[model samples]
Target: MTLDGFAARPLGFVGPLDLSWRDRSAAVEVVGQRITAEVTAIDLDQGLARLSMAATEDSELWAYLKPLRVGATLSGRVVSIERFGVFVALDDGPDHPVHPGVGFITIPELSWRHVERASDVVQVGQRVSCEFLQFDTWQGEARLSLRAAQPDEVPPQPKRL
Candidate 1:
């Protein structure tokens, strides 16, 4: 059976996350050059391996993030909520490369107090200040800690046995 236009094929194809798409010029510069990367995952069936390649220097957000020091208090507004984390649009920074915000706080970092959901700690459009934890190279965003910015009460001494 032959089809004239856009027919569905039985064969399936899937590939890596395609690092080249983010930095084409850098990718072109490394043609035939040997480089090492940490394997994140391997799919034998697909004959592919996801690797964490060194691209910090090639990242566009590096210029805005390089000057920042860890633990520095930064302010931003909550832009989104996700099961994994919350996205924050920093008051002063370049737009995020992949996500809607340049700052991100994982669920664990959302608070010192136990919380059920991200919404329980913060809501969208809420202004918040968080301590800079690190630069997330994968998403080109800053890893932030909201709990660090808030004062934590000293724990009471444990009772005698």
Candidate 2:
């Protein structure tokens, strides 16, 4: 959430405003040229300051730390199911496919009890809470999970006929 400690620096000029250091890590101006240099120490005499990079290589990490946003809830109905995952329509948000990978909940991750099909546990038209596990910004795709959405319940054993 706080990038304050990361690669902070200041933008200043020794001559004309155009002859100052521009931030290349965040944005680049066509006229101004910024020389990239590692920060050595803070210049207290010259009144230099430190500003965060604003961008990070690990956005997902920050997203994970961010508190659950109010009204960010997406209501989706189960569309299809497989041994590996489930697919759902997340209203107007995005079509989320809950898989079995790092962010998905598979048959194995459902419950300690054995599960055959995801449909058996979740049916079509049944609204379930879907949370983003990981978002692929470039692909416009997100890994979702319903395991947390469903209320905890103890499955009843099959009765003898």
Candidate 3:
């Protein structure tokens, strides 16, 4: 495609594609043609954009992991632990472009028991299995639940006299 002798790529029917710093580049297949975009800001020093391609590719990290659905079981190494969650680098997929891992286990999902700190349930380098919860649309990461992968601990029963 060309406009005034300049190459023009069609964005297609996909809804509003908002580009942010988080989205450095992306590619979509439209009508059997692969269209790739590299989003940059206008000023180079300030990281602004005048619409130029830094690089182009047919797919991204998320594309490979797309087949995974909610409730699927996954195993990964606990790469990092934050106050909010534990980041897991999935054993079955590529590393996330921006985040530490494709899988994230939130504090509440880290354990069936009450958790005061994320570290109480998981640690860095711990290999854990988790249940896929959902794909976090904003972060483009998979949400997971370690607690769901483990059997609930049975409490002791009182003795009958």
Candidate 1 weakest lDDT stretch, 10 residues: 9-18
What TM-score would you give candidate 2 relative to the actual structure?
A: 0.38
Sort by TM-score, best first: 1, 3, 2
Residues 139-161 of candidate 2: C-alpha lDDT, one tens digit per residue: 22345656545555667879999
What are the lDDT figures for the candidates, one per model? 0.71, 0.44, 0.67
- Best TM-score among the predictions, by candidate number: 1
Clash counts for the predictions, in order: 0, 0, 5
lDDT string for model 3 (1-161, tens) is: 12233345532222233222255454332455533444323354643333322122213554655567888999989999998889999886776767888788899898888899998877899999999988664466789999999888647779999
* Per-prediction TM-score: 0.64, 0.38, 0.62
Instruction: Output the number of the lDDT-best candidate.
Output: 1
Cα RMSD for predicted model 2: 13.0
lDDT of 1 by residue, 1-161 (tens): 11124344312221233233356446433333444443445668865555544333345566677568998999999999998989999997777656788899999899877778999999999999999999765556789999999887447779999
Order the numbered candidates by lDDT, best leading. 1, 3, 2
Candidate 2: lDDT of 48?
53
